[model samples]
Target: MTLASTGTVIEVETRAGRVRGAWRGTPGEGGASAAFLGIPFAEPPVGDLRFAAPMPKRPWEGTLDALEYAPTAQRGDPGVTLIPEPSIPGDSTLNVNVFTPAPGKTTALPVLVYIHGGGYFAGSPASPWYDGAAFNRDGVVTVSISYRLGFDGFGWIEDAPLNRGVLDWMLALEWVRDNIAAFGGDPARVTIAGQSAGGGAVLTLLGMPAAQPLFEAVYCISGAAADVSVDEAEAFGRRLAEAGGVTPDRAGLSSLSEERVLELQKQLTAPAEGGNPLDGLRQFVDGGLTLGPVIDGDLVPLKTVDAIRSGIGADKPLVLGATDDEFSMILSEAKDKLRWIPSRYLLGKVGLTGKARSAYVAANRTVAKKGTAAIVGRYLTDRMFRTLALRIIHARGEAPTWLYRFSWTSPTFGMAVHCIDVPFFFDCLAADKVDAIAGDHPPQSLADAVHAGAVNFITTGDPGWPRYTAASGETRVYDDPSTVIRDGYAEVASLLPS
Candidate 1:
């Protein structure tokens, strides 16, 4: 079947049941598309199902409404931000939203499945920045998904399955494989992408044997796999249980209200006494109780980095990137304190001292002019994001990997901080929310370059750049006039702690 006309309703069949979606824009309009929102892919992980691996949604007899977005998992208020973070309330949090150029068609289009990021604690598929209309207009089917988060999804309960969030992702991909053809998506040509914690999920899923067949490519932005040890996860879990005033078991956690769980999560995730204000600011930081996939012997098997080093998904294409000033967003908040810290003290934290510290200081004179906060931000950006991106590139063994560094500094902060590239990559610079970060009249040329490159990568295997190699270390730098650089972070590489 072809796409429905403007303002028309379209119905499609899936293995579980039927869903009715609506056309997003008028036909013949520039951004015309079909949107299928709030389609359940798994049973709500509520009540007894909480903390357990996600189960398949029970088949429904009638067509389900796919017009409005479904409720997202329980999460704390995100406070004020330039980015939009909308959360709805309900148990049907495990859902998927699909957008396509042709909704009821048999033509198998390339698919891009995006996972939202909120440090694994908060975020929703309902965010306006995640709209897939641009992708749909580019001849691709786009899917955004919601998964259980925090304690219910990643807390290490004693008797429950580990990495419930990963399971939710797996179930969503399975649903796509079974039903996306009805929505004009090619199950075999799927590309999974995510940002921050969601990016970490993509890397973790790349390492999972069961998830290998679900997607053909991956795009990880400013995130990496959780490196939590089993002992560390259990210790954090026990601490979380105490914070919630409950026993460290599935039953105890399930008994508590979602509000109480979120309260405990916030308390647990706060920086420890006198800890660096930057500790948990970025998605890669090891903030206690900010739930992530565990290296459970069964589901996770091993650490994601290790799995990648061992050549899991080594044949798959990957696009890995991080912003130049990733931690600047959080550092800007503690500028006063950052000014007082000694350079030696900062260097010591990362195990650099004496000549090593001196060399790093001399090599990074550009950032030194910005003060201690900028220095610290540079260190964390490299340690938490750039280093990880390079390591993954080095580890992927013959996989065609493309590396990029987003250097489009925001007018407000003068740094290409975290999440700044979301709008550029999505080609949504026109969205009002983007003005908060990119500033008014942000360069459209850069957006076109970034978006086109990503679209090229999604459509074909390459993104019109040289594949990354340890020897060459070539990377695309997204700026006013984008340029490719060799060994972009070689100076900072040695200063990183082993």
Candidate 2:
């Protein structure tokens, strides 16, 4: 069915049921877009279905009200962070929100499916920053999805399905394939994009055979694949169960209340007293409850990096990147504390003490001028995000890949930090609560460039840059005046241990 004109309510028939959506603006006003919020793509993962792979939604009777955002998996307060995440309460968490240009038709517009990122532990599609109205204005269909998080999604159990969060993503893609047509989206032209853990999800999907056909391209921002081994994941699950005073099996897990489970998740993730601020960062790297996709020998037969090297999804175009100062934002609250720790002690945590640490510190000193804290932050930034991104780029055999680095320093943080590029990429810098990161008057030109790059990649499989080649290692650096640089981190790369 064709979409209704601006300011009009329209009904569209989806395979699961019918939905009513409202247009956000008039076509002639340049703000034309239709938003369909909280449409379930899978059965509510509640009660007996809690830890299982997502099941298809049972067809509903009457027109479903696709008007408001749905509740996400329970999480704690974000507390003065760059993003503002609003939590609602409900069991219908396996849902998606779609935005399309007004007067939708069977025109087969390019589709961009965005998965949110919050370390894979907490995130919501309800963030105002995720508004797809701008993409709609550009004539692209945008989708934001919600999935099970924390232990409920990633805690590995012998009886429960592994990588249930990844399964949720797969089911959401299947829903888009089966139903997006009604929303005027072309499933065949789908580009899957995410930042941080969501970027990790895109990479994980690229490595999975089942997910190959779900998307044609990938736009990963600061995403690195977390391939926890089955044994390791199961041990983490057991530890969690023991901490919560329950059995480690699916029966025991399902028996606990969602509140209880979330509390356990918090206990596992909370920073220990008397520990450095980097304690949380250390836990994340060491596979905390925020454990991501597991290499389970079936769904994920190999690590994402290994799979990419072995040619999984090598034919698809890829755009992957990280910010210049990813770890700074992560340690923003403890920046001053970071100064007190000796460079040797800080480097010791990651096995970079003595000569290795010396070499790394020397190599990074040119860029990290703020002493030991800056050195360690840059080290973590490269080790966790930049190096991993380059590994993926180098392993992308024959596929046209473009690499980028976000370098736009935030006025408050003094560096381009984690999740800072999100609002820019979505063109939602003007949204409520976004000023925390983007400042009072964020750069529109930067947002235009970033958002346009995404749109270009989604529509044409190219993002206005030369395709990455191992020989040159060309990368686009997004700053005040974006410029391309050759091997931007070659010096740091040389010092890294193989």
Candidate 3:
């Protein structure tokens, strides 16, 4: 075991080769850690490998200087999302960044493998907020992995494999299992976690029989499963091909320029021509994933919730939840436009008409008092995140599961908007751009509490919360003073079937 504290640079051996990393602070000071950046786990998915399953990187001689973040699957950062994640252009984007306090120690530590979320099309793993120094300081080796994104990773082709990104995740986990010991990590103590689409990826993997062997625990933060059916996958493939002026199969798709394909993807997501904009919003809410892992009846044989209900991943201890308003701010602008409209009418605009709408309104009566926009925003949160969490909890059926709700409202957004809770989860309030979303004076004490729970859960099976069960829906609500509620989701209970 090669300990990292002796110098500024540290060396560790991986299956592929030896790599050198830099230490952030002297070990004497608290919160010191070593950072190893851009260690490739797979070969560049370009040219012949483009649109194909990820391939492991071949062995290389000598020590690779892993000093900087690698290229990302995203062409370039769009700067539209709440996360300030950037993208560098390069083909060798499938890599992992490791941060550890005890490099190459025989005393194994827990591992946290995080996947970035961008609705399965965008997002980079190299964000400063994702740096593992904090987790490393807490005695856990942390790793952030990158995968093929968007059409190249998820677009369907007759001759190519489906869910290439999913395969990338599995391969990255295999790499961690194989080489993390060199970084003083226990592969057996690996905890896979992510937020939003990344959350959905972990949930999708949890339900997968083949993916069960990869990780021991899961901490899903606002997971939105994209159970794209084969037919839906085929439809989107044809539409993309039609817009690109190419055949939908591998031959024609492979021939189209990457730039052209990206253009077509935009067109596919473009609002319906000569149609109501409201209809587009409705479609976004009603339509499941247009891109992501598909239920191919083999790799992902069942819907994520269905697979859990059927006892898949029942033995793994799981902790899953979301913020109070994961996407509430999505309706902030629409609030004024919708103010005059009655809540019922606004609901109808989003396809929530008749008895079902009435039922949803009744279940979310508390939100109705906040006006139409609030109701709609909470509906989005519930429908897309919170409610799904309820479904998973009910389905777990005595599995050692814990539930939480990041109920602390953000001062910047005035609501616990999407991605707001991420900084708290990582305990990275000092990271760049955190003030933009979490306010200039975001609370570190909050970060301490939220991140402490995460560290506890990763290190031990329990997260210091009572396990949720069918009889008692125990939950930990992270607020100014985090509290435990016997039924944290009682309001959500009325939303799903008993």
RMSD over all Cα atoms, model 3: 2.5
User: What Cα-based lDDT does every candidate model obtain?
Assistant: 0.81, 0.82, 0.86
lDDT of 1 by residue, 219-264 (tens): 8888755656677778878998888778999877877888888788
lDDT of 1: 0.81
* Ten contiguous residues minimizing lDDT sum, candidate 3: 1-10
Q: Which candidate, 1 or 3, has the higher lDDT?
A: 3
lDDT of 2 by residue, 235-312 (tens): 879888998788898888787888888788778767787886456666665453347888999998898888998899
> What ranking emerges by TM-score with the best candidate at the front?
3, 2, 1
**Runs off by more than 4 Å, candidate 2:** 1-7, 27-29, 76-81, 102-104, 275-283, 286-290, 330-345, 495-497
Choose 1 or 2, whichever is better by lDDT: 2
lDDT of 3 by residue, 1-498 (tens): 122344588889999999998888885467778889999999998888988889999999999999889988887455346998898888799999999888878769999999988899989998888888788878889999998877888878888999999999999999999999999899989999998899999999999999888899999999998898899988889889887788888778888887788788878877879998667778887786688989999989999899999999999999999988887787788788788989898778877678777888887788898888898888778878988998998788878899999888888878888888888988888788888888888877888888999999999978888988877788899888888988887766645754
TM-score of model 1 (CA atoms) = 0.93
Q: What would the TM-score be for candidate 2 when compared with the true structure?
A: 0.94
Q: Of the candidates shown, which would achieve the greatest lDDT relative to the real structure?
A: 3
TM-score of each: 0.93, 0.94, 0.96
TM-score of 3: 0.96
